[model samples]
Target: MKTQIEQIKVKNFRLYRDLHITDLQRLNVFLGANGSGKTTFFKVFNFLSTCLKDNVTVAVNREGGFKELITRNSDPEKNFIEFEIKFRNFEQGEKSPLVTYHLKIGFNHGKVFIDKEVLKYRRGQRGKPWHFLDYSKGIGSAIKNEQDYDPKSKEIREDQPLGAEDILALKGLGQFERYKTIKSFRTLLEQWLVSNLQNEEMRKIGDVGADQQLSMSGNNLAQVASFIHEYHPDIFQTILTKMKQRVPGIDKVDIAINEAGQILLKFGDNSFTAPFISKYTSDGTIKMFAYLVLLHDPTPRPLLCIEEPENYLYPTLLRELAAELREYAVRGGQVFVSTHSPDFVDALQIEELFLVKKEQNQGCSHIFSAKKYDDGQISELYDNGCELGWLWQHDYFKGINP
Candidate 1:
């Protein structure tokens, strides 16, 4: 089943004082009201991506340094930030093994540095997990040959020293192919596509002739559209087909390279013989088309974090959008979506849904799966036509304001 992270734990990072999310599915839906930590939760991936793509220092600095990144004013009792991921790896149609990577960092002497980091996995059916890679403050060794396992002792340990204590060991060592585990984890982090699509940005022209993948904030929409249309025509056609089905009066989407060699996106409405430029298209149309393009990319990302996909899209399309996200997951990419729309939530199954809420007084949060409810109870309620969104609206859920 390839490699998929089954669980994640966060401590002293952003709004989550300490949070553990488990039983993660391919198509995970995170439901929460305003200020319930949905965006904060997504920030965890942002922090990790920055660390892997750039460095820990850059990650910290980008988030306004440790002072701003820490959760709830860094309780004197808890002074460090930590994140842990437990994932399952599979190869050749069989489950390979379970692996866990844990990272802890502390801010000291006007700087943030790695206090501890470890990558370990279970060696056999029943036994203590082996620590294949262990490092502290950029000093330590990692296992070279990850496949060779004698089960009693370590094999081929290689000393690794990063250029700086503020650097992430995985970021430095993950470049090599021999360290399969490190490389895989790094790829997942680096390839994560987090969307904060701005409609205004999507309307502008992008740099010339860039083999563009969708950017994190989705500003390179035109360039990405150009890339797909020019390189992967089939995928682009699929996007156009879906776009026409969901969006009204959008027969054709034209992409042209101007004299400056920049790509421009134009919309062709049936009402007009001339095509309308991106800026002239309706917000909902542009947003939905961007989503279709993203979901149908030729090289799908390992993880896609889209916050509030319901925004700017027709309420009626929410259900179809939910199904499309799930389809993307089934087609081999994991999806994480946070939404406030009941229409979108209505389309989700019990196992794929999570309710996230925060306590009023303490500002602490609880994220629980909807699957915790009894199956018979669900069968009875759903059989009676009691939809999940209707239930949510009627105060069936606690801590959420609806």
Candidate 2:
């Protein structure tokens, strides 16, 4: 609830070629066919997070280097992988002016570096916007007195020179608390959770200790479970209550550290006296429990990107899961989910649902709200007692085939 992305723009990044999406919701759901660029869309945040945490070079190399990261069949000479995000932090309690962060990654002669980066916000109701942080390649200038910045008076500025050309300016400047705008954006990037949960990873035993937040993959489910059970008993009990209601016969959930200093998750069934270890539990049970642990975390992450949560979960359970995701968003974390389940879509509001589709021949993806299709026919259909899932399956969302 502190800050949320309202608009995102990407240019020459994989399947997205000059795509601009606006008015993002807190609990946004993306629907698309396989290979229609739903996963690629989520990767945008992952790519930015990696760039901020490490460097531009590392982020590029992680995605198979520059050649593989850029858009396919595009001119390398003219195009650079660019991303721009606009959001409001709500730091002043009421609605605040939009903060814009723009980043450009360029490659030349086998070298990848940050071409440009800027973080700026409009001052007052008019005039030119104030640039809090601005850099190109390895050097630029940033406003030193951001709190008392006055465009009408002489502006105080500081020259910033990074150690490497491939480094993000925010990564360097954010380390200092004086750069409040840069630090806030950096913290937001660091707290984003782009979850692509692997059930197999959740089943494996993990190192001893507790993690306040869940990893992109739910590998440390046991440690997190242990942490919640030991500190936040009320939240843990709520998780158990929800699990029992959704998954029949799940009486209790607990965790233990083995003699080797590894944490193991356990489940109890009312029908049996002996508790079942996570390794012996059903896939649905482990997945559901992992989700519960993640949602019940004491400190919710700023943003959550989950792809296909309906996988390995009962169709009937998906609607409630959708509701839970919305509730988590209500608790101050914005969630982005990509799903193929209609039951999940049926639980969503019109503003929360968007359709992602690849353009014919162009081979690039475009995203827009479902409520905007065919002069609001989709909205009209939904208002007339038709569920979104049925409408989507029947090819009512335009350009999306059943």
Candidate 3:
């Protein structure tokens, strides 16, 4: 089934006191300056999805725990971060339906805890009554116990409340036994939402072994390529062909697993195979390979979030990347990318571009469509010769005559 994130709303979460994001298309792009809370916003969604699928421990560890993650100006008595995400879940051979999920986490006695969680399926433009998945202040197992005692009387007791563990057990049982749809959604997030930063140091060293499935920080690109070669040879060949078109000098790409169990990329020379070292590879080449490894993989993820995709790529390649991202979205994979690259934005549809800006002393963030502002000047710039990054630099958004 195809799935895509439709919207996200955040409250009292790190640099953002309040953030409402409604402009979400298949290929959504967030553009903001450094330290303007762009990555933090992505982190919030990542943390929430991880916590729901795995555990609080995994989420906290990924974000440096409560002290580092919690909002600096958070109220001492009620230090909490809340977010809501709306997603479209497609059924097999059927069109997808919109589903909204809400989550809240807070610090309690120095331990991070989920305060509230709810999932709902929307019928139309308005949201339906939420199916309460996990509510901190709700009658949980006590009601279950009551139901077990008397089958006819399906009434919940108000006074007899379930403890935390009991509530969690009931929720787990509900996911495991009763409701398969919610369980499927949870599983999707757990499996597809890969955070490479979990092993950042190892990835940077390019020491990832040959048999690894996915690269930590894209260091295992060769390993992934090798896996593709052995298992999905057709996809690997297709990627190589496409890459050769982009990079003229590259005759062919191959992954060689050496005796020491290290995987390396071997470029075909006129007469022999030349081993290309990852560390010595150009940044553009490395980034291109990393992206190809993900895109051409046989297993498709429902949603993929990439941070700063413009980090190491030429402006021309950024345009190609943007086009490929669009194709990925068209094929039913939701792609959310955060970038400040104008070339990348120029290659996208105006509706797919979202402008993220921070208002001084507003204690919140604003997201607006680049086309909806002032009769679509931003879109016009992209339609013309101006690149997105340069337009912003020239104060084009500030009503200046750039």
- TM-score ranking of the models: 2, 1, 3
Predicted structure 3: lDDT: 0.63
Model 1 segments more than 4 A misplaced = 76-78, 150-154, 373-385
Clash counts for the predictions, in order: 0, 0, 2
Compared with the true structure, all predictions reach lDDT values of 0.82, 0.88, 0.63
Every model's Cα RMSD, please? 2.2, 1.4, 5.4
lDDT tens digits by residue: candidate 3, 1-402: 477677888877667777777768888887776666767777775766666555665677687766666667667347667788887666533555566777776776666656766665533455343342435643432222221322233333223343442122223533553444456467556545433422222224333354435543665666667778888889888888877877656667766556766666766534445645555556666667677777765766677777877776788888888888777777766777888777786677777877777665654566667767557777777788776667766777662221
Residues 121-213 of candidate 2: C-alpha lDDT, one tens digit per residue: 887678578888889989998889877865465457899899988999999899998888888899899899899888889998989875877
Backbone clash pairs for candidate 2 read none
* Top of the candidates by lDDT: 2
lDDT minimum window of 10 residues, candidate 3: 142-151
lDDT of 1 by residue, 55-101 (tens): 78889999987888887757523498999999876642465677899
Model 1: lDDT equals 0.82
Off by over 4 Å in 2: 149-154
Q: Top model by TM-score, which number?
A: 2
